[model samples]
Target: MMEVIPKQFWEGVEQFNSGQFYACHDTLEALWMEASEPDKTFYQGVLQIAVGLYHFGNQNWRGAAILLGEGNNRLRRYPEVYSGIDVDELLDKSLTVLKTIQMAKPEELALLKLGEDENLPLPKIVRSA
Candidate 1:
């Protein structure tokens, strides 16, 4: 059977994809708090990415650029968490989106799609809810 991703992660991604940047930040931050050392590093990158996405959703190009840039740098330190989860590739696309937005170029933001499906990582609550 396919494993179910953590509810918090899915909730964060959903909030992010749905243009709820603050909610994404809040949800992902919860997950980030409970993560262990190595995993915490991973979640830190993810949180920054979420923050970037939040800024992007809010149309804050400068904020998005800065946070996404940080996220992109953090992404270089990690491998894909699993199949279909290429953190590096996603960061690259996000950076491109941020740069295009920063440059005020007419870019296709729709091309920078993150999955909407609910089937992803394990669904355990890392810390107390």
Candidate 2:
């Protein structure tokens, strides 16, 4: 049986894709709040990733690193693909971005500009086939 993806999920994806990270978090949280255990954790992971990008874009490296690390940990237990998302790819990109931030000095990180010189690590919403 085919299940329909929630409108909230798609709206969250659109917000994330459009770089409205904070809005994306709010949209997804609306869905995640009512979810059960593992699925709730998964949605939280996605929300964390979005907020990580939001922080990164705004030059908040410490916050971004923390959220990305937390998000990655929550997401790690899931399969390569889950709940319509390409989990593996998302994890890879998140890790890549995290590593970049983790390696930079806090002062250097603050100096880093997003969408001006170096681009922020944004995830692609590749729905699983």
Candidate 3:
């Protein structure tokens, strides 16, 4: 386990919360590259979800669903709170977003707005208090 969460992780979270999914992926990728085992998978999960959101914003429903499902599954092995993150909450929220994307028709996907849609608020990474 990592003794300390790198500054980059929080930076990535900030970017993610701000709807800067592409930047979040870049920020977390650096940390993910150096992580091992649990941490490696953890960071990858977060990164994947960020990219998934980016795909959703771009109206790539398939990419959004795949990454969101994969990412949520990856994080499922971890505790509700791991590395100071609320993994359970993240999973729940992302799953809702994923389902919305999965259920949308190809033509309807273009009309869906992430965070702006009443049903599809963008998932945010909540830090454990």
Candidate 4:
């Protein structure tokens, strides 16, 4: 049987992909609130992903790394939900991206100007549907 992805889950993903991290966090957190006890861990992991994205957008690399790492940790305990999505791969991608950003020299970081733009960079998810 196929596991149905909830509308709330897709909404949260869209918000995250759209660079509305805070909104993503709020949306997913609500879903987390209503999740059954056995499912709450997965929702909490999603909530952390939102927080990670929010921090990443804000140029808080360390914060993003920490939150993302924690989220991945939570995800490890429940790999069933991620069968088609490959959560481990996603976590690896995120960690690699953050590490690359963090390894840049201070001058490079200054030049990158992490938070100069008022607009958030929407991810590819926005264009899919």
Error of 3 at 79 (Å): 0.4
* Inter-residue clash pairs, candidate 1: 5-121, 5-123, 6-122, 6-123
Off by over 4 Å in 4: 1-4, 80-84, 101-107, 110-129
Error of 1 at 10 (Å): 2.3
Scanning candidate 4 in windows of ten residues, the lowest lDDT window is 120-129
lDDT by residue for model 1 (49-117), tens: 677766665566677778877867876676654312556456655665556656655464433333332
> lDDT by residue for model 3 over 8-82, one digit each (tens)?
999999999999999999999999998888899999999999999999888778899999999999999999899
lDDT of 4 by residue, 17-124 (tens): 666878888887887888775467777876786687677667777787688778767767755335245555555555554555557775664344333433322222
> Candidate 2: deviation at residue 107, Å?
4.2
lDDT of 2 at 93: 79
Instruction: Name the weakest run of 10 consecutive residues (lDDT summed) in model 1.
Output: 120-129
All candidates: TM-score: 0.64, 0.87, 0.95, 0.68
Q: TM-score of model 3 relative to the true fold?
A: 0.95
lDDT (C-alpha) at residue 110 in model 4: 38
Cα lDDT tens digits, model 2, 42-119, are 889989999998998888888999999999999999988887888898898788789879888766887765445445
lDDT of 1 at 52: 72
- Total residue pair clashes for candidate 4: 0
Candidate 2 vs 3: which has more lDDT: 3
* Candidate 4 local Cα displacement, residue 32, angstroms: 0.9
